[model samples]
Target: MTLPDTPEQTPLTADTVLRYHLCWKHRDLDGVMALYHPDIQYHDFFQNRVLGFDELRDYVRASLPHAAGEDIVHSDRIRVDGCTAFIQYQVTVQGGDGLVAFQSSEAITVKDGLIWRINEYATLVRRNAKGSDRSSPRPATSRLGLSPRQLSTMAQDLEHYFQRQRPYLDPELDLQQVAEASGYSRNQISYLLNQVLGQSFYRYVNQARLQHLLASLDDSCTRMPVDDLAFAAGFNSLSAFYKCFREHTGLSPKAYVKQISLRART
Candidate 1:
C-alpha cells in the first residue's frame, strides 16, 4: 500500500518495469522471456498458482492477447519503491449482461535489473444492464490454469467458433460437443460462460440461435413461418424459442415479423 519515503532504486525499477510492459504490449514473447531472472517467481492469486522461471514461458504466452487491440486498460499509476513496483490494470471481455471485466493488479520485485518476482491478483466484476457493478473478491473457479486474459480469449474463441461453424444450428447440441469442437475442456468452457460471462452454456447457445434467426428475419424471412425458422436455427421446442425471442427482442415472434414487414413497406 505504501512505498519508501525516499527510494533509491526507483529509476532502475522503473526502467525494468517499463521494458517489461513494452514487451507485453508488443507481444514479443522472446523479449519478455529475456527480461525474466533465472530464479523468477510468479504468483497468480486468481488461479491460486505459482509459476517459476521454467514454467513462465508457456504461461506468459498463454496469457498474452491473441488478437490485436484486445481491451487491456493499464492504469497511469505504476508505483515504485526500493526494488518493488506495483501496477494496476483491467482486462475486459466484451459480453455478458453488460461489460464483464477483471480488475487486476501486480507487485513486481526487480533483482539485478531483471524481473525476479511477481505477485498477481485479479477480481471479477460484472456490470448489469442497469449500470450497476457486482464483483467477486476472487473468482469462484480456481486452479484452472487460466488467467483472466486467457478466459477473455476463450470467450472470443467460442464466439468465433459459433460464428464460423454455426454449431448452434444443431438441435441436439450440448456443452460437451462445443467443448470438443472448440478444443477446450468442458469445465473451462463452462466456467467462462457461467462465471466470467455471466450466462449459462445453453443460454449462450440459444443466443447464437436467436442471432441466426434474426439475420434470416432481416432478409426476406416472411415466406417461411417464424416457428419453422426457429427450428431451423436449432430451437428444439417452440416455448424455448419464444422465450429467447422475447428476452432478446422484447417481442413475440409474430410481432417481430410484423414489424419487419412494416419496415419493408415503409
Candidate 2:
C-alpha cells in the first residue's frame, strides 16, 4: 500500500530506511507492515520462505516476539543509491536472560514513495546463553561435550528408533540401552532427553507407553484387564503404571474408561 501524500512521504532514501528500522525497534508492527507495498515480496533465506504481504504479516507476527528488542538497531551508516537503499545494522535480542547479537543488512527497492521489495540477511555475531559478556568465549564443550547440532541429531535418531522399533515395549528398557541402540554416548542421550526434549529418559519412554495404552483403551471392546494392558505397554511395576497413567490422563484408568464410555454412549 502507498503512504499518504504528505511532506513526510519522501522518495526512498536513507531516512526511509531509518524509519523502517525505528518501526522494528519500537515493535510497531502496524508501522512496519504499512511500509510494504501492496504487492511486496519478502524472502527469508535462512527459513527458505517466500511470501506476499498476507503471509508475511502472519510470519512476522509469529516471529517478531522472539526477535524484537529495544535500541537494537545500529543506524550510523546506510547507503542509498538511486531508488534502492542498502542498510547495515546490528540487532541485540534477548533470549531468556541472555543476549544474542545479530549483524544484519537489508536491501530495499522503493517504487512510488513506498517500499516495494525487501531482501534481508542476518548473521549471528554473538550468543550468550548464560547472560555473560564478551569477556569469556562461548564454551566449546557446552552441554557436556555435545554440540547443539549433535544433540538435535541424537534426539531425532532416538525418536525415529523408538517409533520404528517400539523399544519402549520392553519393560526393562533403559537409557543405556537406548544410547547403545541409537549409537550416541550415554551422556549425549541423557542430555538429548533431559535438556532438549525437556523430560527424563524414563518419562519420555513412559509417555510413549501411555499413548500405546490410550490406543488400547480406545478399543472399548477389548476384554483385557487394565493391569495386563499396562504390563503389555511396558510397565514392569503396578506403582509405575498407576503413576504414569494418572499423570498422563489426569484420571485413574477406571475414570478414563468411564469417561470414554459415556462419550461413546452420548
Judging by TM-score against the true structure, name the best candidate.
1
Can you list the residue pairs that collide in candidate 2? 1-38
Worst 10 residues of 2 by lDDT: 134-143
Instruction: Give the per-residue lDDT of model 1 (tens digit) for 1-266.
Output: 34343477889999999999988989999999999999888998888888999999999898888867878999657888878989999998865657899989999988888998899988898887788888855558565788988888887788889999999999999999998999999999888877788789889889999999999989873478889999999999999999999999999988988898899899
Q: Give me the displacement of residue 13 in model 2, in angstroms.
A: 21
How does each model score on TM-score?
A: 0.92, 0.48
Model 2 over residues 1-266: C-alpha lDDT tens digits? 54343434434455666787677666677888888779888755433446688876665553343233332466556667766778776554321123434455778877665677888665544434565544322222333533232333344456678878999899999888887887877876665454434457788888788888889989978879889999999988889889988876789999998998899998
Would you list the C-alpha lDDT of every candidate in the order shown?
0.87, 0.65
